[model samples]
Target: MNLIELSPEGNFESWEISRLKELRAEEFSKELGQSMLYENDEFRLWDITLKHKERLTFRRVVNDFSYTCITDGFGVIHLGNGKIQFGQFKKGDICSFNMKENEELILDVENTGLGILKFIVTELKLK
Candidate 1:
């Protein structure tokens, strides 16, 4: 299932973590990828690739953003507020979010599937 899980989120049943620590958004780099593909006046493009069980942390301060899935995989999101969620994505799947003023999304994502998870994130700079 291709889904952009948000609003009322849920945790994964197979998620076995000895302890869930509070992840500080400010402490982590806000960059979505290790390398930025492109950036201009109105948009920023990022390529993200995560190996199985690998995790990446980032803060979503921009209000308008979209991500296209390049590989099929399962993911787990660990929010800074102690919330957890499971995301199922497939190749060519696209998810976008447009939040209101003063809204932000901060979380860490982990690839839980057996294969790699890859995606391209595009952040729109609204004037």
Candidate 2:
């Protein structure tokens, strides 16, 4: 939502993403035009942001892993020990994939809009 605008100079940590103190989906829906639709015991919500050249390392904590749409900017993601693929992603793109504990992702932001990433995970850890 428009609530947590991240800093442009700081890297991101999935654990640092903030959760609504009151868990008010209604307010988010009203402001952002959509809100958290579903959450169960198996998944926890995550919302994060990254500036250009700022990367975050994340590990899958759930079996059914999924990423929500990117709300702002574009980026290229690099897996652990892999080259930064020429591929790029922009806003409104959603993806799902399998990841291992040893795998890591480094998001290379290519825009100044700030990369907004949201997803659901149960037990993610910083690697």
Candidate 3:
């Protein structure tokens, strides 16, 4: 199962949290430039890193919800058709998000930015 830690700098929307926990296990993966995963059909976590020094925008059009936590560096989140959430971290901020199906997430990062980490958890499971 994928597990992640979210920053304590900001508050997350309650509906976002609910949606995140409802995401299915098979809907996540690790691909080029993106780190996504699911655990025992209970939890899902991933990180999307921007290795470049330039600002870039990330777009995902899936129902399974996703959120971003600033593990390192700085960034802003823009919600196009869905809700996007965030928290700030300096060098050691630990942030995480739960996943839900069919939720869109967009991330904009500055500099050689570190990616966001997310986690989705299912009931009847232990962390």
Tens-digit lDDT track for model 1 on 37-99?
999999889888999999886564544888899999999876655567689988999988886
**Pairs of residues at least 3 apart in sequence or in different chains that clash in candidate 2:** none
TM-score of each candidate structure, all chains considered together:
0.78, 0.41, 0.34
Q: How do the residues 74-103 of candidate 3 rate in per-residue lDDT, one tens digit apiece?
A: 443433323343434354344334445443
Return the candidate ranking by TM-score, descending. Answer: 1, 2, 3
lDDT of 2 by residue, 1-127 (tens): 2222233223233222232121222122111112344455655455445556554442213243556555545554432222333324445556655656565333322223444543332222222
Q: What does candidate 1 score on TM?
A: 0.78
Residue 17 of model 2, lDDT score: 25
- Backbone clashes counted, model 3: 21
| Pairwise TM-score winner, candidates 1 and 3 | 1
Top TM-score hit: 1
- C-alpha local distance difference test of each model: 0.73, 0.37, 0.37
RMSD to true structure for each model, in Å: 3.7, 12.5, 11.2
lDDT score, candidate 2, position 98: 60
- Which of the predicted structures, 1 or 2, would earn the higher TM-score when compared with the native? 1
Candidate 1 vs 2: which has more lDDT: 1
Candidate 2 stretches greater than 4 Å from native: 1-40, 58-62, 98-127
Question: What is the full ranking by lDDT, best candidate first?
Answer: 1, 3, 2
